[model samples]
Target: MSKKPFFLSIILFTIFLFLKGNLLAEETVKITLLYTNDIHGRMYPYENSIIAPETEKIGGFEYLSTLVHKEKQENPGRVILFDGGDIAQGTLYSNLTYGISMIDLMNKTGYDFSVIGNHDFDWGKEKLGHMISKAHFTFLSSNLVTKEQGEFIAGTRPYALKNIEDIRIGIIGLACTDTTVFGPESNISNYYIFSGEETLKFYIPILKEIHKADLIIVLSHLGYEEDVKLVSKVPGIDIIIGAHTHKVIEKPVLKDKTIIVQAGNYLAYLGKLEIEIDKSTKKIINHKGELITILNSQIEPDKEVKYILDKYREKYEAFGDTIIGETSTVLTKIPYKECTLGNLIADSIKITAGVDIGLINSGGLRDNIPVGPVTMEKIYRVYPFENMLISLDLSGKDIMEIIEQSFSGFHAILQVSGLKVKYDSSKPKNQRVIEIMVNNKPLDPKKIYRVATADFLALGGDGYNGFKKGKNLQNVMLIRDAIIKYFQEHSPVSGKIEGRLENSGKEK
Candidate 1:
């Protein structure tokens, strides 16, 4: 054998080894991300001894802990936990405990980061600030900023970068733009809410340039559609975990290179994503995702989280046990296509306002009233949202527009008081509102009218986004306060279902 041939063979073997080693070094790292949203401070299962009508209780901090632990165990060291937000208010417990309990629970549950939700600011900016300070995980928000008792306004951080297993992931938080409309005056009246798209535009370049993260993830409370729109306006976002629409997305919706996932509401589901990244090339190789249902039969509750939850449970019962009034007849809330309870409550607001008509968004009705003795507990359950009563002097044309918008869609099923409206559902959009009358009087299109409605509607609830554009807006009263006041004045009472619904110009 020639020595030249032997040398050539050695060189070929050495080159093969070098190329193989480079390929092995470029291998991707696997990361599993778990997400939840709109927990609404449900520390314990919905199975409270105080409230009746038994349904399978699914979510609680304890159960959530158990589920998250299982997820971690499944993925071992490659898991990341996140909550999209709304850990502030909703139930009797959050309202009574002032959100410290929930914060403690979130810290205990190992949430790595959470975006500031609209409800997080429900208790006001000071309280929200305190919650952020107390939280163990980073409270990531890119849009909300504080006015330092001066004229200057600053936007929140652009995004946060997390380095896990050689992969750099940037997480940005986007608060809902409807903060001005949904949140209380005290929480956001001073600080303005900028467009989510604008904030993202300002941040994306900075994150890419400064952080040099391989991937960008947006922790958004801007609802799914808004997130979809955002990805189109701003390029380069890899994933968007969204909330505020309460949509239980089974699969992540990918739009223009942005993958969006929302874990529904009330802690009923978890969003999961697995991403494989090439460390050497600094690129995402593959991604997989799914939504896991948190059913009662699936997992056991964590004892420590349960213990903390039990303490709040006791506190909740104590607060709700207060006797507000008695009902001679049962006032129950039935989850119908159109709710009778909603009609009654909305009528209460209209009566309180002494207005010609009143409307309440059915979405604002949180819980139900059982068919028995009425207590503060019952009232709280029936009308859970802390909504205020807002009045508007809308012209006849504005009222028609509002009605047309509501009736033409799945959302416009009216829970009204002191008015009868008849509309054709089959008519073209916005033309469906056929006839509207206040006290047997046909609606005057040119005349100004006083209307009472829940604050949620004033800010556009259930696709009625036009309410924000309504003229002469005035917060005449709060819906909850008005209801409480009505109970105080009326004492023990019962109400008959008035003829609120009537046939319009057409048949269904």
Candidate 2:
């Protein structure tokens, strides 16, 4: 062969290899994950301290819909939308529709997948199935399964595989871990729910080996801390988007090379994550995530979604718009502490049941009752759950146990009425309640007392297991109705943080 020909061929081959290498390096695919959690049917205009620190109202579902649609339009086929759940029960509209309206909105907004939150099962398992049936997107839960064969529950799958461009994305959805405990207990026991770490450990390998997923995303309804703990246990997760704690994770948490992000609750923000994947390595080499504040002022509402909302507003306006009563001052919830709103609601439940003591879970009180017209809508927002009121007859010892659980801090302290409880939280668990006075007298261990609370607590929700000891449990009315009735009977009512609960341990 001629020397010129051999040298020319070598130069051409080097050029060809260089071109191929550059092409492989530039062949990265860009993927955007749009997510929202704990929207809680808060589709209406409301003031949020998160997005706007000022008095301005933030969030309208139409605005969220617009922002989501805009991303889809701008990105074309590279976008996926997921909600961390809690779409079922929050606002009057969502509750009235059995969450079908929210499903309709999600369908229109182009959600790809979502997991079921604990509150989603609030209506009942059957109702959750109905809501799932209505959704245009898939619901995934690796943990919740029928006791038989350990199969994923009906209407939900363990994981979903999507091929976007050259990358195969595998998403494992983990439902709310507290589903059983935060339940209308009778409705949630058939299926077995597992821990996030266990479930993720089982599925991560399947996704990586069998499916050859280029990236793994775990959409979790287990709160932020649990998500971090799960990441610590499960080695292969690329990202975890979580809910249930209603955390405003302003910055994405990177642990063990995995990213975790949660948008604040109540439609305050839409979560957006952008990732660049290397085709050759099939890895997310770079990623950026942010919560887009849904400022109603910035974007035009989606007309179709807005029309649906308007229709509901007009139809239900008469239902919630009627002036139920008035409040002389604002009644906001303060978790694990004595708050005016909790006191007011507890008082209402106590008086309505004609019981000696009233107790309520602080989580049951979602929003604050502002000073002015106390409309049914406001009450609905505050007492979002349809928890029925129940009266129980229990010995003073059982009452003391319940009081101790409140101070133990496993959950928010139970709000109380008609009793003055003093807890030394610094003391050992189950030994916190140092003193209790009922009706200006000390609690009698032998004396049976009448107690009123939402059936949720009576059924052992939020870990208040002491309610199990009570006898003579009788159903009162829907909790919201009791609150409304209280307002009606007392129209110009007011609430203040009266030291009904004294943490003597904290005084020092």
Can you give the lDDT of residue 110 in candidate 1? Answer: 88
lDDT of 1 by residue, 138-200 (tens): 877777665656322122344677888777888988877774335543356566577888888
Candidate 1 root-mean-square deviation in Å: 6.3
Cα TM-score of candidate 1: 0.80
Point out where model 1 deviates above 4 Å: 1-26, 47-55, 74-77, 146-156, 186-189, 323-337, 370-378, 390-398, 408-414, 444-450, 455-478, 484-508
Task: List clashing residue pairs in candidate 1.
Answer: 388-479, 389-478, 389-479, 406-412
Q: Give the least accurate 10-residue stretch of model 2, judged by summed lDDT.
A: 179-188
Candidate 2 ranges with C-alpha deviation above 4 Å = 1-25, 53-55, 148-151
- Residue 78 of model 1, lDDT score: 78
Model 1 residue 136 CA deviation (Å) reads: 1.0
| Candidate 2 TM-score, true structure as reference | 0.93
Question: What overall lDDT goes with each candidate model?
Answer: 0.74, 0.87
Could you tell me which 10 consecutive residues in candidate 1 have the lowest summed lDDT? Answer: 149-158
How do the residues 286-352 of candidate 2 rate in per-residue lDDT, one tens digit apiece? 8888888888777888999898888878878898888999999988898878999999999999999
